[model samples]
Target: MAIYFYGCVTMDGYLADSQHRIDWLHQVGSVEDTGYDDFYKKMNVTIMGKRTFEEIQNLPDVEKFYQATENYVFTHEKELKVKNYQAVEENVLDFISKIDKDKNVFVIGGNSLIAPLLDADLFDHLIIQIAPVILGKGIPLFTQSEFQRFYHLDQVRQFGQFAELVFSRKAPLDLPIS
Candidate 1:
């Protein structure tokens, strides 16, 4: 499972505004530098929380929005009907484990999903689109994680209201024999 993250963060590192809103995303101009369009093309399966999936539904051209690939949603109650979507109640790891690791898996979310993968050491890279707004208070794009490690910055690009940051997890340090 080649885990990757795709989403944006505020200037202050928050994912959404105080109301848990991300209306600014719609106003973002078309900039290929973000690599979002390309990322979508490479992904075979998408995983997201119900709330995040619902937000996508509210956007215009919902069907066309996710026409790129299959979707696997992790939700408890809501049932969504999409030709390429399957809802799973199991933990993210469990669901992720079921998929063939030979293909790339895109973990799409506001934070809930990102935090888990980061904690479990499952992600291979992160694609962060940082919006130029400081949401002093809101759901942060990266919730405080307990794990402490490093990520090598791969690339950076500036767009209209967002800057794209690509990072790959650093190699684990080799411990000396005690």
Candidate 2:
């Protein structure tokens, strides 16, 4: 499957603050400023870590926040009775590997969940909008990992005070849009 990550991070590379809050991102740019609507149009399913799901649930009118075709949450819990989300306790890599190769999976963040997938080289694309402000310390976009990976810059768009950077994995993933 074509796996992609979509998030807004600070210039310093943090996804959220120490409080698990992204108010800094909102302070600098609105949802449209991040081009989330356009990005979501290319995704069939969204995969997020449990903590990230919880954070979304805490938001006002959570149901509308992630209106994707399907939602999957990676959690340690074996059972989840949530109405709209499927809980996966299985290996994230294994789970993703089994999905249809043609499908586009959007990996939502919280850093910890992104590290393993990133380190394993499972992501096909990454679209991050850099907020104007920087929080010297907070939850980072990339977690601690030993391996190194790189992506080619496909496009960069500037919107007022924000900038959207889109990168695609090299070689096989650099094909032109169909």
Per residue, candidate 2 scores C-alpha lDDT tens digits across 78-161 of 765555678888878888888888889999886766888887888889988788887999888888588657689999999767
**Candidate 1 lDDT tens digits, 1-178:** 5888888877888767777677766565544646678788888888988778777776566777667777888888556765456788888877788889788888888577777777788888888888777667888877747767577889998766678889887777632334
Clashes of each: 0, 0
What TM-score does prediction 2 earn?
0.87
Candidate with top lDDT is 2
Residue pairs with backbone overlap in model 2: none
List TM-scores for all candidates, in order. Answer: 0.88, 0.87
Worst 10 residues of 1 by lDDT: 24-33
In model 1, residue pairs whose N, Cα or C atoms come closer than 3 Å (at least 3 residues apart or on different chains), thus clashing, are none
For model 2 the local lDDT of residue 36 reads: 75
Q: Residue 127, candidate 2: how far off, in angstroms? A: 0.7
